[model samples]
Target: MRMRLLVVGLLVAFMALTGCAKNQMSTEPGTQAGENAAVATDSQNSNGLSEQDLADQQRQAMAAAEQEITQNRIYFGFDKFDLDAEAKDVLKTKAEALKAHSEWKMLIEGHCDNRGTEEYNLALGERRARAAYEFLVMLGVPSSNLKIVSFGEERPAVDADNEAAWAKNRRDEFKLFK
Candidate 1:
């Protein structure tokens, strides 16, 4: 009886291993059936993305945007649109990059940390985006190649209730236009 049971278990394990190996080989290109199988398997599995996978996806996305026009949003301290020395330095570099590529268009998205009333935050965000736009114009970026939008406090980079997150949430984002 023991020998019979051991034999059965070994057969079951072998079958499982064989199935996995077949699936692995199916993912290789040049095999239409395998490709279809792999796609079916991936579709069936809705697991969350891994960190490394997420990073790889982000890299691919940036590469795809390489030829498109890009925009950068300049962040600011609460209640102020004045560019500090560091912010000014960042803007200068951005200006040079944009001027070098005249065909690229950009949209500056202004955002604020979640600390103020919605209406107030929206105004602040608009001010921040406008400040960057003006600086870019002064730096020789064409007005026709730039646009602006303010998201206010509704969109926070970090949702945690902490100063560190707030600081990160208050930022300007750059979107690329194809």
Candidate 2:
């Protein structure tokens, strides 16, 4: 009777090991069972979004937001922090975009031409960035969603010492954050 019990136990162990091995070996890619497993994993979770689906949506949203920020910039006048008509128009468009996508946060960088002293340029840049920030807030963009930074004359948009280069350097740039 003891011998029969030992034999039955061995048989059960062998069957269990074989079943596990079969499952592991059958999970290779390109197999129909593997494809089905992937589909099962993509089914809606408790949050109603599959892991893969949610990741794709996040990637697309980030790309669109980055593009929007990159496409819009406001230029400043020589040694001036005021927003001209053209700058106001650009800000209006940017404000509308920001309103539509409330999840985005931005950094407004103030820059200056290489004409002023370092200390003076830094102050000017700060004022320029602050002007942009205030204008955006007035246009209905939440002040909490924006930050201001002054690069001064350290980073020039164009390195040439010509008027065109100076014009490009005196600008406010927009950058996106989480």
lDDT of 1 by residue, 1-178 (tens): 9999999999999988777654555456769877888677666646656656778887775554543324333457766767887777777766666776677777788888888889999988888888888988998999998888999988887898787887777777777574
Off by over 4 Å in 1: 1-73
Q: After superposition, how far is residue 29 of candidate 2 from its true place, in Å?
A: 26
**Predicted structure 2: clash tally:** 0
Clash pairs, candidate 2, are none
Give me the displacement of residue 83 in model 2, in angstroms: 0.6
Query: Lowest lDDT 10-mer window, candidate 1?
Result: 64-73
- Worst lDDT window (10 residues) for model 2? 19-28
lDDT of 2: 0.88
TM-score of every prediction relative to native: 0.58, 0.64
